[model samples]
Target chain A: MTLTTLPPPHHEPVAPHDLRARVTDVLLRFIDDQDQILRDVDPELSTMTTALREFVLSSGKRLRSTFCYWGWRGAGGAPDDEGILVAASALELLQGCALIHDDVMDSSDTRRGLPTMHRRFARWHRLGDLHGSPEEFGTSVAILLGDLCLSWCAQMFDGCGLSEAAISRAKPAFHQMHTELMAGQYLDLLGPARGGGSSERARLIIDYKTARYTVGRPLELGALLADGGPELRARYAAYARPLGEAFQLRDDVLGVFGDTERTGKPAGDDLRAGKHTVMMDLTRSRATAAQRAVLDALFGNPDLDRDGIGKIQDIIRETGALASVNALIEEHRTAALSHLTDSLLETETQATLTELAITVTNRDY
Target chain B: MTLTTLPPPHHEPVAPHDLRARVTDVLLRFIDDQDQILRDVDPELSTMTTALREFVLSSGKRLRSTFCYWGWRGAGGAPDDEGILVAASALELLQGCALIHDDVMDSSDTRRGLPTMHRRFARWHRLGDLHGSPEEFGTSVAILLGDLCLSWCAQMFDGCGLSEAAISRAKPAFHQMHTELMAGQYLDLLGPARGGGSSERARLIIDYKTARYTVGRPLELGALLADGGPELRARYAAYARPLGEAFQLRDDVLGVFGDTERTGKPAGDDLRAGKHTVMMDLTRSRATAAQRAVLDALFGNPDLDRDGIGKIQDIIRETGALASVNALIEEHRTAALSHLTDSLLETETQATLTELAITVTNRDY
Candidate 1:
């Protein structure tokens, strides 16, 4: 599955903290350069650069870049390949676009302990005593910023100083990632609209939105950039698929059960939003007729109080749905870890990726 | 200003009709390929492909691509370069992205005599009796579609079958076009929010939104694709700047005064929307106190009547604003044509570009 038989490791695997620092450095430098370009266009345009810089530098897991870097290392790419860092950092920009637009679509007010992009802009509109609806202004500004981030993602990827052949080889994977992300988002919107509450529908959304987009694509992109053969890419996907799903499953668990301060969201936020997660589907299927009435009345009520959330949690636990979901998360995490046991991957890469699988699937936030 | 000396024409200039037909061919083929990709992902996704196909093929002036093609030819590129057609056609997708998002921002119900993308999606939501607000559903779908178009524009441009040198040479123009278009859109939004009615602000918006985006970048992209020297690109920009401004001026005039059937919009659409065009700035500055009072009362009023529109129109005429705008258009048009007289450009290209200048600036819709 590996591209080549490499020499024994001469150095320890890159720590996640080190990888994050490098990614931040690349992003900060790129944003500064863009700030100059936008300033040259007009002084007013500096607002966009400022917003982008703040949102990007504020907070992120940098998980996608970490996985991508390991994918490259696993495929025998040099440890000191600076171009790969730039290429990996592009994913963060794409992630920003997704989060900004997702917040607008969901009417979300906060993220990572601060107001969402649209909400932030709306506050600016109010502060300026600007004409028109502040909410509309905020939505428009967020949309434009999301688009600029998307465009910058491409620009950064192409200008990463990688070899022409490497870039060309990875272009198809990069392009498909964009299309798949949009498609998955569309499906997410469609699911609730179509009254889809089945685990099947929920799983399908997670497959596209999280598993493939967040993990498989980034990993494959790195492998392709390192000129890895198709076999290596398949192995990456095998590991990424279950791990990504587990990552999202953990997120679902946190939405209802995790501490508000740690998760940077209100308790039971998904219940208030009526989000149709797999856990919700499991609960619904397992609920008795009497419990179903409680579910129907309480779930999706924007004004649902703390007491209501407790009742729902009690039902989920009573029916063993919560335990079932926890079991599924553990099962997927184990499956993902099993793929890293293949001998083709370098020993250090295997160890790091194994650690990553545990951390992503077991994190509190 | 052209890059090289060329012999007399072996063929007549490509007529506008022929170029449009060729552009349509490229677009249709690209859409079909994308249709297969989407279908492979999910059958339900066919709705996106169908909507995109209808919007793209139904009606468009193809002005950007026309200017780009001629820019290439003017810089000594062959008329029969199919790859140039692909590069040129990418502009149409970018335009699609702009118009779709513009409609959402404006909350326009119709475009090109048909329901806008959001409206169309809203109707679909209604037909299916879907959950949530249909308006919100429509906005979400439109946003995703717009992002998809923006990504496709870059994908198409890179895969245009051109040599690496040509693609790399044109990449900066392509990158800047995306950034400038978004920045211009932000300024357009900022203008009215800030209550800016100055002609200077209007002209700045036109420079970024229309002049540079619609003409300057496309022309430079074509020239660079042909490997034209800096002199040729600068010459193209000189011609493009004035012509593009005139083109927007003509659009402003049509927005206020053109027949509804020809314009595919309501009567006095710009006035109803409170658009701050250069013509509007001129009208405001020249109005008497009494006329100004009338404008302040009726302009931008969502429910403005025909009588109110007529009064506003009469004041613009009485103040000579309309006539002055027409004069400015002619002056810019003359300047644009003057750039073509340079002996470095081929005779046939010069003639075709001159013809194009008149058509774009004089169109009804």
Candidate 2:
């Protein structure tokens, strides 16, 4: 048989949008499977399964899966590896567990312009006219749902059609990713508990809470699947850690200064929540007497409104902390990209990773 | 090999108290390993780890591990099976995770006469004189700690040194145990939401939430590891389910009628918390119109005090509901013990399981 023709060599690398669509497809299918499984256990749980599907599939970028995909490809993995896609998609459920529980812990009412899980369930408690206090009902539902998601994460990962050898080899990385992320979450809880930590401590939290699992370990998981040696894993981590920090730093900036339309959260929402983000630490350390007075009056104030937020924003700008943070982001972005230079990854994978790096640093949301 | 002496057949079967202490040894060692791992990650997290170890090793009867060990021995597993013990101890950490998060979901202030994880952390927040509301801070800390416990459960299980074949075989059972428990919790949330469910529904909740996982699956996990056949597993489940149901029924009774010193909860704490247990369903169904009205007024009332609790108890006794419940417990207890006959288990192991069945039904706490 004669080949007709070949596609152009200069075609763009795998677009993140396409990757996201595929990952979402895998996730939705998993949710549907879970619905059926849960149905067998109890039909009364159908409402919960429906909410779980919505909470998972309806929102957020599948960023961790993307990192894993590229890392798999970079480690000489095939383009058509469905096992990687399915296994990586489990990360979304893990992320879902984190978000649902995080919202309850933070008492957040909204996420992605929709009511957070606890808020929705709390309202459902009232609307269904269920027994007990609505608030407790909501919190309980979220907790149970979250625990379900976490259990499903392990179930999906083990059942993802990967060879037993591949799964066994990659188990440590997977396990470490979870332990680190949970520790980081604990560190996040400690931020305010420490009564306004030093800036260095804030950065440490970012590294543990956001960096390794969010970026590095996802990549490492992919690499491990392809038998990525220690050298390759280290290289993947080199690119991952700095990039993950940059991502969170940008997120912190957007939390304070980004438009609500793009960010999906109200302006100064993190401040009012007393997030104790690195941005807050940096700005507070740099603020003048007048700026400090403004921060003290308005920051984390429950009654904080547009005008009060505007005052804090104005002070942040005046302190030049905002500009310094941007400068730091640029530094991290450069350091992250620098790791790409010597990596043995394929050209297409490299192109996609480069695209991802840019998207993370520059995104408004 | 020369036999020095013949062992006496008059020796006691697996004493639960002794088994509990041995299981505690395994758990404490595991926690120590985790402490080292976590310490290497962050020294600042010492308090969280300490709390976790204490919360795990300091309390509870190690019932699941005991069930698991005897199940292993009964399935003809070796006496030298450290893997079985290690895998079984993982259940305690899983239980710890469940209790910590469950307390948060319930907004419970105390557990085992100690402040619940959330309450203790909240108090820590206040004591630290840190930022944000102490209540919020405490809740956040508990959520993270619970999440940590959950992740550790998986890690410890996978690292328990069981053969890959054994682990593979047991994975589904372990995963299902988690899913069912969470589903049972969701159903439990529905109980109060349903405004006191039917007796059958309450029993169903107990079966799902407590029985199958707490009693049955631990035994199943042990059997699976031993490569026990379907007949053996079915036998274990038969013995496990009814016993577990009886155990929970006894707990429900103790929640109402047992002494505070023995129960580790205030008298009638379940009534105050609006726990829609089998005891509540049985008692309420048997009440007169005036008693029903009283039940409605007292049950699920946040302000329910000793006086209100006494009234509910009086009605339960007057209507003979308590005696009927005890009869049901006995029925289940007998059904459980009957399954032990004609079993494949070793004589000593069978004896231990029989011993366990009695202790469970008779427990004061």
Candidate 3:
């Protein structure tokens, strides 16, 4: 053996683009395997499998998986571990399940500047000139597809080629992640049913539905996989929780005010859908009687025109709800980023995490 | 040490009622644990948890769990094992998920003589005079509850306290069961979307949607848990596959002709839903031109009245389709039962399985 070349000191910090590409590659191979399973059962499932591949591989920031990757790295895991990549990729499949079902419940027509899952299938029904109501067909297909994603998530995790003990160690967090997310979804349904929920209720929803599910659990999952000690696990949570809150707050702002082209969702869409976001709750709490009246008339009106939306927008800003939300977001971002500055984690990991926090919380979409 | 009558010489052969009671006991305990998890998160979730408890505990024949138990017994697993009971009971939760989603997709009004999951929630919304469309609220709740059941199924299975190796061995079958069932559902959806399907298509649907999932996989799971050899596993599949098909055929017969009081569904419910059942396909294929005219007019009519149903029923009999289906059921039942006799299984196990096969296939409901 010649000493012609020496191994690099450590794997270079995986670039965001490279991380995304690797995740995508794993996801594609996984889906292709699943597609074969479906095909073996029946060729008629080709359409559904094709649609799933597209829905999963198509778009959105791979934030959850990236956070998981970094969490593992921060806990002293090898950057080049293939098993960690496989485990991290499972989150995207779970997210796919959530989004597909979410769109069905919301009756959303579009996502990512294209037809949502149900809408796409509904269009397929119309084009095929198939029997029965196209809308119902779409909804049914979406439900089954969502169920498939959920199943595939478990299958992928178990088949990730990790040691059985390691998989067992991570199982509790995985189970908790699901239960919490579903509970959050259930609470979200309650808001619309019970009518104009309190800001506290909105915050609780944020904790379970968006913050923990979108960020905290993914990080914990990664940390656990690396056999990180309690101290490291606590650090991950402290960094993740506030950052998650900030991320959702940003989403709330984007839902109301961001450009549709950038966000891939209509401006004031949350208001139109009557979503009980914290910002809306704050606006309700702070608005003048006259402003409240305008909100009652214009907010949540499904057919609300530009004038109505503009009026509600004015009320949100005039009552200082928008400013307050922005301030809260900044506070969360600061609290999250402060943990990284004097951390025990490696310098590269800290720098990467910091950049991620800024990019997520400060995004326009 | 007191021998205590030597454990009753092979466990006294658990009676059907006792087996059901035991399964119910385990399920109640599991749900209680899950209920605490929900309550710890939010008190508002109490209603949802309560609903889940009632929906799960109130009804069902517990056939899947029983079959799983017998599968274990036939494979020489310990009759007194609590872990097997836990693993077996997981099937009930899985069934709950499937039925809840099935009801939603079918827009079903009732199940087991009570309002369906969605309808029950919708009615609650109406009674509370809550905001938004009650129908939409109901659908949303059903979807979430269904997802919860799916998650809980996995959770329960993982926590069953079986050896890791045993659980790992059964994992592939458990995963396959879900994927196959979902694909079956997808195929069922395609039937309606593509218009009236052929008899072969209906048989394929039965094989996947009903036969393999409801029988073959559960038996395989139990057998695998016992470390049953390939010969024993093959025998279980042979017994289960045909029995499952017969069970579904019986269900098809009951859907049209069984008493509403016994079946817990409106008479001719499947016809109203336009389900493309094997019997229906047979009827269509065999009907004369004049008979076909009546079949086309009366079959799959949503508002099908007693007289219209009678006309279709008469046509089915006149075409010899009902007789053909009945003969097919007998053929499958005999084929399934033959695997039990002169088998490697214990005599007691053979007898109990024989009883189950007859009861499932011969039931009115």
Candidate 4:
């Protein structure tokens, strides 16, 4: 079945509000504690660390951590405060580190309604009259700071005090998450360099880079930590796969059409960067000669200005790319919901997860 | 006792020849196996992966892995075929990954008598006629490839089937090693940016970054995994700490005065790059006004010619920096050997490790 056709499960609606709120609260506290540890390490380093923590902890869905928490809960594990929170926090820290490094790699200049970490570091370099060129100093700081976060993430996991058996069982999944993410990143880097590959190849890259790392593996990791058996692991995959796809599909749409004010990025930034998104692949495959000319002229041009971005957006819309992407998002969201029906979770837990799936796909920014 | 005055141990010599040969064989075989897995995943991606594996596995002292193996053996652990080798190999892989990324970050052009990974990728980009600027493409490829190596390192460790008890015991040391390495890296980066901190601060960075991560932690990790108690762990530190300092001191000397033909890197590259070494701290502190002027003119100029590098080297030597650094290296090496006397290890194992320490510090390259 496609993602757009699943029926909603029957359950009282009160459970999700409480669970999501609890998860959000725990996440905030986790970030604060980690920030304190970072500060204690080196006061001078704290400014960048605090900024990075704030950027990541700023308002967002926190969906991955929630999924991990619920996955643990669904596997019949008790909510031991330290274990669950540490596990979830570790995931968040990993994500934070990834996003900061990804931004610098992508040359993104803004995030979450503020200057991106690299850009801020550049500003600080100028103000402080640091020894190196401002840009080099900025990039260096970002790299080191990201490395710090990555190291801290591992430390948190090691110190989490989880049962040895549980940690060992979950360890492979964690390693896979990192390896797969890097593989996905490599594919993404290679995609544009190689020009165009098969539609299937492009889709595979998207699935690996975003879908699998963002949702599938996280859910699996949580379940594994909770000692969930293979059946439960299999059951979670059904929900995770479609949810992941829908999530990426929505991101692609936002890349093309979302407002900068709401998204906290330049409009059509992805187009300017020549990201090899699924939407771009579909448009390239199906566009007319005139549309192709538009792409050829503007795609990957470093000098593409505001007017150029506008024209590219117009072409995307006129070619019906936006509608098709929206349709895919809906399709995957429905498919993800359908998977929940077959899952052997508590009714209340299943309902909360289902609602989460809907909110995730429908997110505006 | 101070690190410079310890007495050497009197022990029967144990042949490390067998252990070294066996460990090297296992490491190469495992690397080849991992390469096969990469090829299976996607033959197209194997080009970069193959080059990376070959480049890293080519030739090195394998000092870290050797320490790990010896630590395990010294702790009375039996030499298992796959277990110790796998764990040691994982550490080696991690070291390789760090080196690859660190080389790029430092903008070095060569390693081990070959083009650095970034330069290699740049050449590939030119040959392949990839889309963007070849330099940018090369940088992107190296970055992603380094990330892949890091991920693979973690994966190798995850697959290592150490008993939960052993891993749990060893895990803290593992995490601290990473943390200290990164912290040391941060200090190194900051040293140049801040135009050289106090001499003591510079020494601390070298100790933490090079000495601890390279030697001390590797030995401790292996010992911990073998279920060594606190007394045993303390004994490794007694040997490892001074040896690590000597190792860094030797590296500092090599950075300034090593032969380019043997080192692969250009002689005095560190001086030309204005690396904030402890030697630099000493030189700057002791230089006459004319010498200080010369240093200020050439330091970090990025346009320093061969003559300029030679002049800087002369200044360092004339200022007594070279002699001081040499004396420090000898002092630390002597201290390290002295500590071997205190280790509660088998006579043969103590002799082997002591010999290994001498080999590490006295290497010409």
Best-matching candidate per DockQ: 3
- Top lDDT hit: 1
Task: Specify the poorest-scoring 10-residue window by lDDT in model 2 chain A.
Answer: A1-10
Residues B183-262, candidate 2: write the lDDT tens digits: 88888888778774677878788888778978899999999988888998998899888988888988888888777776
Off by over 4 Å in 4: A1-48, A79-81, B1-41
Q: Would you list the rank order by lDDT, best first?
A: 1, 3, 2, 4
DockQ, computed on Cα atoms, for candidate 4:
0.52
* Model 1, residue pairs in steric clash: none
lDDT of each: 0.85, 0.81, 0.84, 0.72
lDDT of 4 by residue, A250-353 (tens): 77777666667757778767877787777787788778999899899997777788899878877777777767887888898888888788548877568767
TM agreement with the true structure for every prediction: 0.94, 0.94, 0.94, 0.90
Candidate number 1, chain A TM-score: 0.94
State the lDDT of candidate 3 residue by residue for B24-111, as single tens digits: 8888888888789889878888777788889877766887788788888888999989998999998888888889999998898999
User: Worst lDDT window (10 residues) for model 3 chain A?
Assistant: A1-10
lDDT tens per residue, model 4, B190-290: 66777757777767776677667877888888898788878887888877888887888777777777767656677767876788777888899999999
Q: Could you tell me the lDDT of residue B221 within candidate 3?
A: 88
Residue lDDT tens for model 1, A58-111? 866887788788889889999889999999999898889999988998889999
- Please give, for residues A163-194, the per-residue lDDT of candidate 2 as tens digits: 88888888888988888888888877777667
